[model samples]
Target chain A: MAIRQLSVFLENKKGSLSEITNLLAEAKVDLRSMCIAETSNYGIVRIIANDPAKALEILIASGFAAQIRPVTAFAVPDQPGGLAQVLEILEENGINIEYMYALVTTIADKAYAVMRTDDEEKTEAVLAKNNIELLDEKNV
Target chain B: MENRKYYQPEFETMPVEDIKKLQSEKLIKQVKHVYENVPFYRARMDEKGVKPEDIKGIEDLYKLPFVEKSDLRDNYPYGMLAKPLADCVRIQSTSGTTGKRVIAYYTQYDIDLWEDCCARALVAAGADKEDVVQVSYGYGLFTGGPGLNGGSHKVGCLTLPMSSGNTERQLQFMTDLKATVLCCTPSYAAYLGESLKEMGYTPETIPLKAGIFGAEPWTSENRRQLEATLGIKAYDIYGLTEISGPGVSFECAEQGGMHINEDHFVAEIINPETGEPLPEGEKGELVFTCLDKEAFPMLRYRTRDICVLSRKPCSCGRTFIRMSKPMGRSDDMMIIRGVNVFPSQIEAVLLKEGYTPNYQIKLSRVNNNDTFDVFVELPPEQFDDSVKSISAKEASLRDAMRNMLGIGPAIHLVPPKTITRSEGKAVRIIDERKLHD
Candidate 1:
């Protein structure tokens, strides 16, 4: 299943990230997972927050460029080959993964992976056909 | 209804000869008025070996020495006043740095005439007593607000004195009052149009029927955008605080160019370098000679605006000569590698290429060569997650800008809200070469 993720535009300025984190912290929004893609002049901080709608509201209200987007998140077994099987399924389906990151969850003996694929619907369909468990906002 | 089509039709539709005659008579008196009352004008005239009698009429307008902005600054607050301080009722200054602002004094009569000019603009934009005029130009020291506010009253329209910003309140009052006319800068109008769309209000749902936008340089493309967005006929009103503010000229339905109020202000195009008057239709710096101003009379004042003037009769029945939308201010023109590049030109290209007008121009001299760079915000709606995609967008914008500017510039697509804006205006130019110099 797909869950909402926050994509924030950050200018390449020192203390800008700190400013963003401080704003979210003051609002009591917990960051569950995050990854950053950087260019020479700017960066995009992708975040999966426990309360993504709240985090987005605060970030945008505080004048940070932010948006809500859908990305697929799924739980995999803790074993090393668990993540490989998911990648193998995606590679076989010819669906390209744009970016992927790990999600912080409390479920024991299980790891969560968040991914943005070129064809999100096809990726989730393939994952469901492969009998992999999908994660929604409720669980992750 | 027929009379409502033209405000002050006697003057607006005056014959060319009569208009020129009226100007000559006013100029003769104004020249004498400034010479006898203000020492600054008299000294400048004496230095040039010219007398008030030398300015016999419009033909001898060149006989008067042109007054530059520095002359006004040199004379500061009270040095340029032709009327006594006790007689003057109001003061309006240019929106410049505070250290040496060019303060313009206005008598009650001057304010009435100024409001009449603004009323003429409103009427030209199809405004009347039945209309509700919403003025969004900033008030206090800035002439846009007060100028239009008084004009709306003169036209007998229910005026909403919404002096810029407070977009939420602006929209509320606009809907509640059913404002039929909007007055503000073109950029602010665009923002309002966008906000209306965001609030799910379409052009059909809004009551605005016309807009009079001025005080900043905007392209014809921008006019088209505003017209479509607001579903109204967008008109251009041209004026400067030095010349009694927004109603020196106005656009009629034809929308070819703005008609100069020749009865009060005599306009001439002159070679900026040599001060020789250019023939009609030639692009040059605009000069004005205030014919009827009483408190702070100006004689052949150099306006530093580059534009062309034409006498082709307009269908609007106005005999006043028309001046094209100014190309750009003379001082605002940048010579990058011997090529003149104006921020307006860059802005036109940006708007044509589907970009917002919020952009910053960065210019620096690197190792004896001018390095021109333009920073444009990649609006959040157009933001992409992939860096390559954004870089491609920047490359295309750079190519388009080079095609228009005749000089290539490095274009950086930064995130939205990165550029600094004061009072809803983007600081467009940053010339670092001045720092090194």
Candidate 2:
């Protein structure tokens, strides 16, 4: 199943992420899962918020370069090799993942993980064919 | 090779008095020619209360009015042409940097003399018919390629009009044809050298023996790097599209300073602020008076390049006066990778793109190459949360800048108010290269 993710472009400067968080806090938006990708010149903060659309709108209105995209989320056994198993299935199916991060919420005995791949349709199809449990936006 | 030492030995080896006499004669004749033909010069002369009869020789050159770069912009297309358009056969222009492009008209005779100057430069650089000359400078409207191309022909060398870029083909022809003389900007020469080294070729193994590099400022350190990397003697050639490109002045075997082609153009150093002529060997703004150019003859054109002139005899046996490599510019113009860039031009691009004019230019030299980056503040209204969308905007801005500047720079969209301003003025440029030093 697919859930929305917001990616914010920020300069690699002091207080940039803090300022963004402050703005989102003022807007009453909750960031569920987030990961930062850093480069020499700038950084990208990929986040899944309680209300992604609202968070994105507020970030843009506050003068931040941000965007929203659909990323697949799935639940795995709450064990050491849970992510490795999902990665193994995706690799065997030839689905290249651009990035992935773990989610805060999970089902009983299962951990939730978010993934973005080169071919989203194929990735979702392979995971579905493998019978791996997929989570929807409402589940996240 | 013809075993000839100089292209025009008579002019190049003339006595100091004879050179001055020749310049005076040409200046006197040129003054009357421009006064009679170009109304702009006449008006300036009239406004300054000076007449053609007053300019007897080079000593009285100060009596005439000095033409500034603004004057060129004020009279854009054909305003400064001393000859009619029909008589002009070619027009080479400076890469547009802010306002109107400065166009230089060239008649057939003007082209011939320009090529002759190039030939002199090539011969000075040890290029002859026996050497294969590869012209790597850009062609078409830019004078570096065409000027040196003609000069290579004049020198009777097997000329390769390779232009710029396409490293693979450049190397193929360079090695296959056994190119002995390479010509391009200092940075490009450095790149070719690095590429050659990566390809397992050393200076001893490379076929190149000499290189003519110019169209931008470079240091002796860069010269040493280019010379060692390419395994060739790197020589500096000086010129601008405003006053016939590439061969206005060039270095000889001595490599002390570039020798001005006094037989064609008269050189003078003047105080940048006061316009008073400075004596020889003192650094000041350099100026030129084209004595032979007919189509777009510029008289006492302020070059804005700060350098000194030397009359001390050179070991190279050329009696022509030598000009030190331009120390710095009097204006905010920066020669990045051999293209003129101005902060105002970058600011104009930002304003046109609906962004605030709050931007900063970061210039650095990495591995003997120039690295340029521009950082612009992202306005609140134009902020997009998507890195893809924002990166697309940056790419488009880079394309627009390349179209305007003839060189592309990495564009970064920084957060709003991040480009701090001091004293109500944003510090626009951060140059880490220390280019003037």
TM-score of chain B of 2: 0.97
- DockQ values for all predictions? 0.28, 0.30
Docking class of 1: acceptable
Best by TM-score: 2
- The digit string of per-residue lDDT tens for model 2 on B1-437 reads 25578999999999999999999999999999999999999999999999999999999999988988878888888889999899999999885446567899999999999999999999999988898999999998889999999999999999999999898999999999999999999888988899899999999989999999999888898898898988899999999888899999999989999999999999999999999999998999999999989999999999889999999999999999999999998888888988888887888788888988989999998876789999998776675444565789999999988877888999988877778689988989898886654
lDDT of 2 at B56: 93
- Candidate 1 pairs with clashing backbones: none
**Candidate 2 lDDT tens digits, A1-140:** 68889888788978988988898899899888888876666787988889988998888777676778888988875678877888999899888887788887745556788878888888888889888888888887
Report the Cα RMSD per candidate.
Answer: 16.3, 5.2
User: At residue B270, what lDDT does model 1 achieve?
Assistant: 96
Give per-residue CA lDDT, model 1, range A1-140, as digits (tens).
59999988888889878888898899999888889888888888888888889998887677666788889999886686888889999999999888888888877777788989999899889999998999988888
Q: For residue B108, give model 1's deviation from the true position in Å.
A: 0.7
